[model samples]
Target: MASKTSAISASLLVAGALAAPSASPADNDGRRARGEAALARITGAEGRTVVESIRRTSPELGDWIVDFAYGDVFSRPGVALCTRELATVAALTALGNAQPQLKVHVEGALNVGCKPDEIVEIIMQMAVYAGFPSALNGIAAAREVFEKKGVRTTAMEAAQPVAPAR
Candidate 1:
């Protein structure tokens, strides 16, 4: 009798595993394709690999990152990726927990047409409002990205030419 009960329990577990509604392959494909498209749109082909890595490491979070962030929020009719990246940079920089991601978004910001100067200015603004520490960390993070891309910080300073004395 105990053996029969154990067999029945095992059968039920197997059934449950078979019946579990996993994310559909088509759905997964669509999400992945959209994610790639969105990443390409914002960061170009070179940066898409990084975004793909993010997806592979955390499938569940990747779904939200791709489907929700890139698909739903980013695909909204009016808001461009550049604008969204700016907001993402600011939010991440302000939160200060996800500095790595903030660095990626800094590159995303540049890929989507945000001038380096604009990003530096945003970091400076965060320093004043979000506190010096957050801003300092944000600058450090952004600097890593700039260095990786072979962009010098002086370019940002040069872009914003100071007015000469009257």
Candidate 2:
């Protein structure tokens, strides 16, 4: 019985080792390509502008954005791009201090086929976890992005103050 257990453990160890991804130059190149493609798919024409702006201040940071954030993480399979963008929006909203990034992700979410209302829903959902203030700020950012794109949503109407009964 012990011998059988040892054999099974050895097999499992070998399987785990085989399943792990090895870092090679070719693998890195592939990851970079996939990441760039994913970023381009999400950001469209704005990708260059975004990366260039980041590069002007921190080139390494810019590369990591493209290579790690986009490439290693965003390019992974399973979750849809639209879902990923929404998740990003949610995370940024929860952070409450990344308005610029939140706005950019709001735009990215729109680009990836997320409806304005869906963006609103995600921001509103963040309120439960991140508090009313964070949700309010996030919704405001989403509203700005929507307005810039000439898109309208129920969230926009919600942003307006109600008049008291005369």
Candidate 3:
């Protein structure tokens, strides 16, 4: 376990560009503060922005996300936030149909220090156990995320190569 974690930690250092996560002031103020901090560390700016919009339209859901998901669950010290987000990416990939949520968590995984290659490797491994279809979808989603985050991929570059011989 220690070796595995060390390997992952080493690889996560290669995370691609991602929006910085910011902690919003917890309205509840006590545990809220800690949770918000954890949330920011994991989800960063993207999570805050999306939650703010949710708060405007559905206060209950937004509150639940901040108070429960970020606050209570993520605040726990059993696992590192970096570990948590990676696990999330793996689970989402296994589900095979949660591309929307997978996309966000992939970014979150990066925000929490998961490298682009690590994310791809994680999903790629799932292909064998989770079957080609789910793995294929997971790869597609990860590719979209890499593109969105401006991480250059060989295929993407090939698709939009620089013009020459003008």
Candidate 4:
């Protein structure tokens, strides 16, 4: 049963990621500009901060996140942002080992209009398939995410550009 659900989830993710319009060299600049803007709109200010931190830690990863994940995958037109985040939250919960990422998506879910109870029920439903431990951990992570909204990812502080002397 769990395997079936996992397969279904995987299929949905793949389906959601179907190719978008091709990007030309000339269009790359425009697409990227639009991607960045869309990323900002969906993720909100806190997400931008985390993206900056991610960029500092891993330039390639950060680019893929903003460019591919948020820019391309997320900006895909078929699904609305709320639905997308719900899928993300469900997938993370089903994995039973993605608490940290779950927290972020849970917050993203809220940013995109999912209410707290809705999120609670989402994870609560996972308790059966994923087991109590995974659900507990996910709930805990969600609590922490709600308590504190911003991130200071590893090396982000160190990588911060220092201000010029006055």
Candidate 5:
């Protein structure tokens, strides 16, 4: 019995050793491509203007935003870009520090197929869990994007709908 267990353990160890490395050069290239694509998608004409303003004001943080946040972290395949953007948007909105990135991610969420309504809904939901202030700040940022795109939004639209008369 002990010999059988040892043999199985050895086989498992060999299999693990033979597995491909998780972070190869190819992986890095793929990540860079995804990051560039995401950057382009998020920074549409107007969004790029926002980024340029930031770069002029804070060059170091701007580099980190492009390289680390988008390149290193977002390029990973663990989660879809839409999902990641939603989470990032919510966190930043709640933290109330990075409104610029929050707006970009909101647009990113839309570019990646998340509807404007859905983004608003996420902010509303975050309000319940993260507090009114956080949600309010998030809404403020989202409002800017909606306005830029000429999307009409109201508090009633964000609320849950009631069933109509039978």
Candidate 6:
């Protein structure tokens, strides 16, 4: 069941990605510009902080993050920003070794209008493929991000009381 869902998702992502118009060589500057805007849109003010931190170590990587990740991939018209952020959150969670980046995308997920419960569900869903350990870490990351953003998780949502069986 999970494999089928994953396969369908992968197919959709590939099809949508292929549908995006390719950037031309002359679009280098344009790509950078679009990337900067996309990064700002997705990550808000933290985008600059992320870039600056990366620049302190590898300036070119920073440029690539903006120009390639944000500019070229993110700016593509196939997927909505919120959907992309959710997908990113899922991928990072599945990787299980990128807690910091996962946290960033968790925040990005919220910024792009993914509900706290929705984000939690996505991470929890990853457990099926990424294992409980990865899912647990992803939940921890999501919890921290939710705390910082002051959003409530599904764990914190109120549930209706159930009557005892007679």
Which one is best on TM-score? 6
Could you give candidate 3's per-residue lDDT for residues 54-85 as a string of tens digits?
A: 98999878878888888888788889777888
lDDT of 6: 0.89
After TM-score superposition, the amount by which residue 113's alpha carbon in candidate 1 deviates from its true location, in angstroms, is 0.8
Instruction: Judging by lDDT, tell me the better candidate of 1 and 2.
Output: 2
Q: For model 5, how does the per-residue alpha-carbon lDDT over 1-166 read when each residue is reduced to its tens digit?
A: 9999999999999999889566643255565456555577756565556656777989756555656666778777889878887887878877877787788788778777777777888888887778898889899999898777676556636778789989
lDDT of 2 by residue, 42-153 (tens): 8877876889899899987887888888888899899999999999999999999999989989999999899999999999999999999999999889889888999988
Q: Which 10 residues in a row give candidate 2 its minimum summed lDDT?
A: 22-31
Per residue, candidate 4 scores C-alpha lDDT tens digits across 71-98 of 6788789898888988888789889888
Candidate 1 lDDT over 38-127, as tens digits, reads 867876665556656766887666567667677666666787777788888888888878887898799889888887777888888887
For candidate 5, the clash count comes to 0
Candidates 2 and 3 compared: the better one by TM-score is 2
Off by over 4 Å in 5: 1-33, 46-60, 153-166
- Model 2's alpha-carbon lDDT is 0.89
- Misplaced by over 4 Å in model 6 are 1-29, 159-166
lDDT of 3 at 93: 92
Off by over 4 Å in 3: 1-29, 152-166
Candidate 1: worst-modelled 10 consecutive residues by lDDT: 24-33
Worst 10 residues of 6 by lDDT: 22-31
With a 3 Å backbone cut-off (N, CA, C), the pairs that clash in candidate 2 are: none
Better of 2 and 4 by TM-score: 2
Residue 6 accuracy (lDDT) in model 3: 91
For model 1, the stretches where C-alpha displacement exceeds 4 angstroms are: 1-32, 44-57, 153-166
Give all candidates' CA lDDT scores.
Answer: 0.78, 0.89, 0.80, 0.75, 0.75, 0.89
- Give the TM-score of each candidate: 0.68, 0.76, 0.68, 0.65, 0.63, 0.77
Model 2 clash count equals 0
